[model samples]
Target: MTSLELQRTNLPEGLEELLGPKGLLTGEEAREYGRDFMGEVDNAPLAVLRPETTEQVAEALRLCTEHGLSVIPQGGRTGLTGAGVPSRPDHEVILCLARMNKVRWLDEKNHAMAVDAGCILADVQKAAADANRLFPLSYGAEGSCQIGGSISTNAGGTAVLRYGNTRDLILGLEVVLADGTVLDMMRALRKDNTGIDLKQLFIGSEGILGVVTGAVLKLYPAVAERECALLAFPSLPAVMKSFAIARESTNDRLSAFEMMPQNGITLACNRVPDVVDPVEGDYPWYALLEVSASKEGSGLFEMLEGLIERLMEEGLVVDGTVSSNEGQRAQLWRIREALVEAHNDMPHLLKHDVSVPISDMADFIETAIEKVQAIAPDAMLIAFGHVGDGNVHFNICHDLDTPDGSLATRHKEVTWAVYDLVQEYRGSFSAEHGVGSMKRDALRRYRSEAELAVMEKLKTALDPQGLLNPGKVI
Candidate 1:
């Protein structure tokens, strides 16, 4: 038998025997894991290894490395970037941690929890809630996105303004290196003045450094009261003005300040079922404000009301509505979630997850819109996201009346225009989505030579073979 054919045959056989039939999958059964959450990448791997323990993962990595095969470590596969799936068909093996879903322990006193990397983010949040604590890392994909993927991307969600990103919420990590070395740093302590902080290296590395097997996550006090408001603005400046006023007036109680455009809200109300706009009339922009406190009778509702009243009188807020109960609050937040869902099926959509300084967000959006319009005059800009943290999901939808492939042809030009504008404003082209295979070019173009050199040196130091999640990040 040929060496290539023999290697392929023997690799699967060894994996099957080591991991058993249930743990290893090939052929059509493995195709589903090959695709990402957005169905953007559909290249099937040579084999899918579902390891339930760290020891199994270590052994699997050793076997794959010996065979000169590349391995891609995947969690829930809910990432927008093509980081979790195979970049090429039958050339790489996917090491998925779905079967390792388990909550190891929860310490209420320490306000910490230890969980297997495959545990769903929602499950972790529920466990923390059950312990009378809060896991503040939240987004729409919490239902299916894994904790490991969240950490790997250093995910930032709505609550990042108050609680910070997944990086801040993590106390420790348990990682398996490319050469089968297990770096178990899963300590639950809040303060460990250890050198180097090895966990930070892998947090946002996107699996190129190592496979995150588990984590010890920090938690906060459970929220006892929350106030939600949907405010309308005549322009982007007005939105920022209201945000500044809300932030200072709330006395650091602002947990979320998401911005949504009129067109985005319209699309959500039209495309997504059961999603209705809270504001009666159409304004140029909208902001979804949320404030939460741990203790009851915190007067957050009164605070929100007073802030809105002052903003309305100041003409910063043209129209607004505050949620009186949980149902109303959910309905208001549904508009934000549905806006994202509205663009899922657009074939030629240009999605930009960029971030700028809070002070420059207004100018950045306005300038980006101008730049995009210059490229594609008919393009619809659906700008929305966690404006509190300055991350905007600046997406452009194709003009439906135009030819089918016209927008696809200009995708690169439009993306570069937006990215160039982001760079000009000292903003990041890839804010929260990560630099998977999709944004690697932007990473190269935007990052300085010094920055890239440090990244490459670290990658070489940890994963010399470049086998871990190949073709991603650096």
Candidate 2:
């Protein structure tokens, strides 16, 4: 072991006493926590702290504060942004919430479930399903992501069009401040109009304000019937027009309106195993839409059929495929879910999670494609995302024919051009993905001065010593 390992094992004062041998991890045992999902940034921390209970977390925080040790709160480490990982890892203690995974109780009357922050989202969804209810915070990382990280980042996924973001699914939160003080606001009430809702402060703060230890998440009635369809569009305008029509025609039952380009689907079909194309032939754009009803006999299938027929007649959709059973529906959804995993194999790729006004999405895509092609002529664009919510995962990959170092030289220019166009259209550069260290500069460039000032003031007020997740999210 190195001198750092010895020092970490021999922690300062009350820390070792509060957190036992299993709670504290050092050297190799703690090394993996320092790395994130994408291996682009690596920061080996001093130690990894695992506190099983809220009291344990509080004591750890209090001890760290007293000893002047920086604490970086981390969850499943599935975030695209570097929020869970630390910049100054040698001096930071990663507060991993792995041990706090537990469901405290299910309030059937209140239609909510109180869960520890470390609870896996998939487990929560399963629990809700067991109770004959639904937890609507669906995402690709549901199998691994913890509730705390989801709440911290305010994750947006396919279900955002219907159930809203993670913020909407949460009713209350129990957080621990930098000084180890516990702010318990775990109320399972929907109509709490008493002053400012304290839980909202830490919802999307990304652990900059404090660590979320527990949450009371809102639940909904489980869907009894649903329909899934994959439709091919001749152009981007047709996709946007179809989105508007879907929203207006579905009677508010449309759960997901995910868009994918031909290249994106091609990438998934070619790279990811067991992910076959749902439709025949190729089109410029496609949409994987779902309409679900809580009642069994809600006529959702009939409604979808009528919508598809009308779209065909209007020349909006050139080709389409609808799922007749659960197996087919899951297969259709897999194509969309595997897109990110497929693109993960690219040698050099640039990713941007941005959102534009629903009305300007088509124009933004057309103009961005032209501009990006001009910047990197050999680059292949793979743009797709939740077009219903106006969030697009505008991404590009270096063509195999391009010479090495060419993309590296033009990376910055291409990024700036894309963001500039997004800004020109009055869209957000960072949509669902929070501003972690990777996007800190972008946040500074795009965010308003007054808004940043308020965030800084709040940070100072909460973490006066600046020891909690330093250099993250304002």
Candidate 3:
């Protein structure tokens, strides 16, 4: 039988009745949620379940579990990896959290916000801002990505240098297990000496253990004074030195320290609209730095200006443009934001989100670029990312001069070549992007047998039938 016919034939008897017409979707409705952001995985799901309430999600999971049906927990479906999208859409049911979106409560006094898993991250940030607080988990997809997906991947964005990852920003989570058991630990507490902290397991678990239903997120004071600058560095070492000096001088006010290569900037300017390089002339490398202080009269702009001036004077910086206003700051940030879009304008790209120690970032990038060049001479290395937090989006793509070749043919070799170097540098193969189906094999190969065994045990203990997000991570 055909995939759709097989799915329709095997669907649980009470699924339709339990979900109602609007909640359960099939055919075109289900097909719409199939592909990811980049259309990398385009297989259609068996059905899509739009559960409005936590109880409905519980019921759906329970029914799917009873019928031995694997369900993929979906968020905004903006993930790069095929985590939210169904890889095996022939049989998998998509449990989308879009309908469950709600900002449950905002505690301004406590500097915490309780929100449903389905709430868009931008909305969450706005809610926090509405209360005169800051969410601090800023990313390119903030407007589209969901809270649950962000937490599931333990998203690390630009501000992770100061605020930490999504895992660190969250205090508690309300998760639904494979068998529909609700683990409600959503307490808005800064300190909890509770046993085990089961929430942490599900935070970065990528829905292997359980589906994140809701969360209580930490918040911070809103920035009263802010300064952003785009600086061109003479060398990688100079960028590193500038980072140290800025971090030390700013007194922990350094909110973001992003690194970008000239080639990537050129690509962005050529392909992406309104993407202008803030720093004039051609420079090998650049750094986008931001400093912010919540308190009024903090002299943050002066501090940033003085710091940049000192760096330029020291010969660490070749050229630079400091943001005079919020509009200018946004314009400065647009260069980094336009990178992925510019890359998509190309063909056959291999993106690797890897991380190493902060000190090793420059060396790792330098060595990896040379090694990748040796492997794929024609491939252009678009190296850039959050240098402050040691994460790099070391993406490789076909250059204009090279004849377009099959990316699939060279994918494995190029992957290993990059990953092997990442391993050598004591860096993680997968950084902000969690181990979805894309990096499952990498996890097995790199991780110790003992670690894999322990993970399997946890999987078995939590999801005995192996029904929740099967073929993802472990």
Which residue pairs show backbone clashes in model 3?
A: none
- Compose the digit string of candidate 3's lDDT tens values, residues 22-126: 888888778989998877788888899888888888888888899999989999888877888777857789999998889999988999999999999999999
What TM-score should be assigned to candidate 1? 0.97
Model 1 stretches astray by more than 4 angstroms: 1-13, 401-408
TM-score list, all predictions: 0.97, 0.98, 0.97
Winner of 1 and 3 under lDDT: 1
Model 2: per-residue lDDT, tens digit, 1-474? 877657575555777668888988878888888888888668988888999999999989998898888899999999888889888657788999989999999987779999999999999999998998999998999999999999999999989999999999998899999999999999999899999888999998889899999999999998899999999999999999999999999999999999999988988898889999968888999999999988999999899999999999999999989999999999999999888788876857899999999999999999999998887877888899998999999988875556664556698888889999999988998889888888888888888999999999999999999999888887
TM-score of 3: 0.97
**Per-residue lDDT of 345 in model 2:** 62
- Per-residue alpha-carbon lDDT of candidate 1 for residues 320-405, written as tens digits (9 for 90 to 100): 89999999999999999998988767668888999999999999999889888887777788899998898999998775556664
Estimate the TM-score for candidate 2: 0.98
Model 2: runs farther than 4 Å from truth? 1-5, 401-406
Of 2 and 3, which scores higher on lDDT? 2
Stretch of 10 with least lDDT, candidate 3: 400-409
